[model samples]
Target: MTKTPPREALTLAAAMNARRLSKVFVADQLGVTPAAVSQWASGHRPVPPEKAVKLADVVGTEPHLISARYAELQTNESGNVVPIRQAADGADERRNDLVIARLENDVDSLRYALGALVTVMTVHRPAEGAAVAKAIRKHVPVKFVKQGYVAELLGVLDKAGHE
Candidate 1:
């Protein structure tokens, strides 16, 4: 009786097989050739970081799950030298922090512009000021409008409406 060797685990090929996806289909989704997919499937080449994320999306898994290189990049970016074999919650938190920081910056810019707009409308177009303020409040979060220039604008609009 002949015994087959144990199959390698934690491989891209395994992930694809579990999803029941063919190499040609995956290659088409990734805009790569079937030969390229074969190389990755056979573990002859590591998936490049640029392609890793897209490949993960194609396979319905996280990049680190399918690509050691992506996991290495995440581990290194976190300022740790320890090799990670899977995605960690800490990595997700770090990525979320980056997105939140960018959104906060954009909100700050919007606040400044909205403040200037309110001031202009109040001075030259008093009748339109309340409408504009209402529109702004409707679109912006309550917490945002409750502070800073937005707060001042709402206060002014309220007083104007009362008088």
Candidate 2:
């Protein structure tokens, strides 16, 4: 019996298939080594926020999706913003803060987009709304959902549904 040879692993193959992005291209764009990109793609290393932003830009995706840290940088129990990484120096720290603020703004925009989707689904197709919302909830971070906006929107949806 002839044994089949093991398939060779292609670096960043999924990204290449989905977005036509190669590890070399991403490494060049991010000023990092292909090995670093491979580490991130393999989930062996966490992507930093700044690099996550650049990676998302290169791959045409959201930073939160790339960086676990950014995804967890949501409001706290006291409604205070969670702390992000602090730079060692002054200017870098300020810049990092600005990036964090921008990320928060992006999260707000995502929430608005989700709210619109939920509104449309609930009003146009009640049955599918719950399913769509469930799928979205599964993907979104728990802290983001616990922000109270989703619940408030659902209350409005319920009122509309009853009428």
Candidate 3:
């Protein structure tokens, strides 16, 4: 298994106290639960590098470097928040894209299967039963991941056409 990153023993509470701030105020500023702030202050949980870096400015302490993951949030002496080392972000986006592509493929397969079924019924059935087949075809339901419920009548499924 991969090793976990090192955690800094941050004097978060002291820093907050020096800045004349309360735990709730610091917790609100960090967008974390008060318990998390308490944990960080009491050394129960190590300070996250991102939070450590962010709190450096707020608590007047040096930004503790933890790992490459926090490099994206690197702030310069000019104090500009630069978005760098986006490889991890890119990987996540690629994974999401793959999932969406697979879902679209599944939808396409479902539509094709329904079309074949409609075609077989429409072709094999006699002229007298054409209206019944047409009705059944119109009533055939297939689910989609997005765009909600829909029915493909006469072998046609269009998102814009329905909604």
In model 3, the runs with Cα more than 4 Å from the true position are: 1-10, 65-163
lDDT scores of the candidates, listed in order? 0.72, 0.64, 0.54
Candidate 2 global TM-score: 0.40
lDDT of 2 by residue, 44-99 (tens): 67676668667767876655556666555533435443433322445445545666
Q: What TM-score goes with each of the models?
A: 0.42, 0.40, 0.35
Highest lDDT model number: 1
Clashes by residue pair, model 2:
none
> Cα lDDT for residue 31, model 3?
85
Clashing pairs in 1: none
Clashes of 1: 0
Candidate 2, residue 43: how far the Cα is off, in Å:
13
Clashing pairs in 3: none
Task: Please give, for residues 48-99, the per-residue lDDT of candidate 3 as tens digits.
Answer: 7657656556566555432223333354335543333333446545544655
What is the Cα-based TM-score of model 1? 0.42
